[model samples]
Target: MNPNEELCLCFHVTQRKVANYLRIENPRSASQLSDCYGAGTGCGWCRPFLKKMFDAHRAGITEADFPTSSDYAKSRSEYVKKGGGTPPPGATPVEDLPN
Candidate 1:
């Protein structure tokens, strides 16, 4: 996903925001990412991604590739359909993804 794209859809947190947080704050743990505008605290879709990014940062990798925004959104739609998460009212609505 693009750096400006929303990684945490529920809270509208971007990858850039998280990355900057990681770089500037040098958080001691991945959980500290939750402190970045309530990133992983939302519908749970971005938690794994956040952890991976955090790990990458720890490993000295500056950037990690992600699926296209379209693909990622579609996957989140499926995840929500399967009851994997409950997006809050202000979240980016789960789109009715095409098969």
Candidate 2:
């Protein structure tokens, strides 16, 4: 193989690029990864393979095991406090937190 040929025809992502992202960023989820690396933003054709790589990067057996950006954001003390969960130790008002 030439090793530089694009794999995800939709996104023009390549295997080496994906591997580099896994090495450099250590992203937590496919969505987070997409935000940083633009993985699944095209025609959704590379989703399966991208998901597979993302899962492997996170040491997960499946993508479902990973957290969505919303999930992580919602699970934060800010959302929990809004949802009625007690603020965590050293918690600050959402407005006071850095934007």
Candidate 3:
């Protein structure tokens, strides 16, 4: 995924923003990313990506380690199957969320 691309669609948060947040705030866990303009709080599609980025950042990995957009979609599908995130109202099927 492009660093400037919208990672959290609902919040319009970008991967760069998340990266910067991680670098500056040094959140202890992935969930702490929510403090950064609620990056992983809405829709939940970006939660897995957020975690991946957070882990990579902590491990001193470069942004090149970030997963592709397709990978993020696939992982997010599995995450939804595992009941990892909360879908907002009217978000039936849980596969897609409102913009």
Candidate 4:
């Protein structure tokens, strides 16, 4: 994922922001990331990614190992199908999101 890409689309939180939060806060679990500007709270679209980041952070990984853009798109599609709000303008399209 692009660092500037919106990981939590509802809150417009970017991958860089989440990574920074992880480095600063040293949260023990993915849920704790919600405290960072309500990252995984809204719509829950970013939960999986949050967990991935959290696990990576706990493992002392400094490099980003984000899921493919298509994975994000598939997640976003399911989120919207379940009544979550639409992704912001310039967000990745659903066709790109699905597996």
TM-score of 1: 0.95
Off by over 4 Å in 2: 1-3, 60-99
Tens digits of per-residue lDDT for model 4, 70-97: 6776768887877776555544454533
Runs of candidate 1 exceeding 4 Å displacement: none
Which candidate gets the maximum TM-score versus the true structure? Answer: 1
Q: Residues 1-99, candidate 2, lDDT per residue (tens digit)?
A: 122444344345565677677668777776655653455554444456567777776774322232343333333434444553443233322233343
Clashes of 2: 0
Please give each candidate's TM-score. 0.95, 0.49, 0.67, 0.73
In order of listing, the candidates' clash counts read 0, 0, 0, 2
Judged by whole-model lDDT over C-alpha atoms, candidate 4 comes out at 0.77
**Shift in Å, residue 18, candidate 4:** 0.7
So what's the TM-score on candidate 3?
A: 0.67
Worst 10 residues of 1 by lDDT: 90-99
- lDDT, candidate 1, 16-41, per-residue tens: 99999999999999899999999988
| Alpha-carbon runs more than 4 Å astray in model 3 | 64-99
Better candidate number, 2 or 3, judged by lDDT: 3
User: What lDDT score belongs to each candidate, Candidate 1 first?
Assistant: 0.92, 0.50, 0.74, 0.77
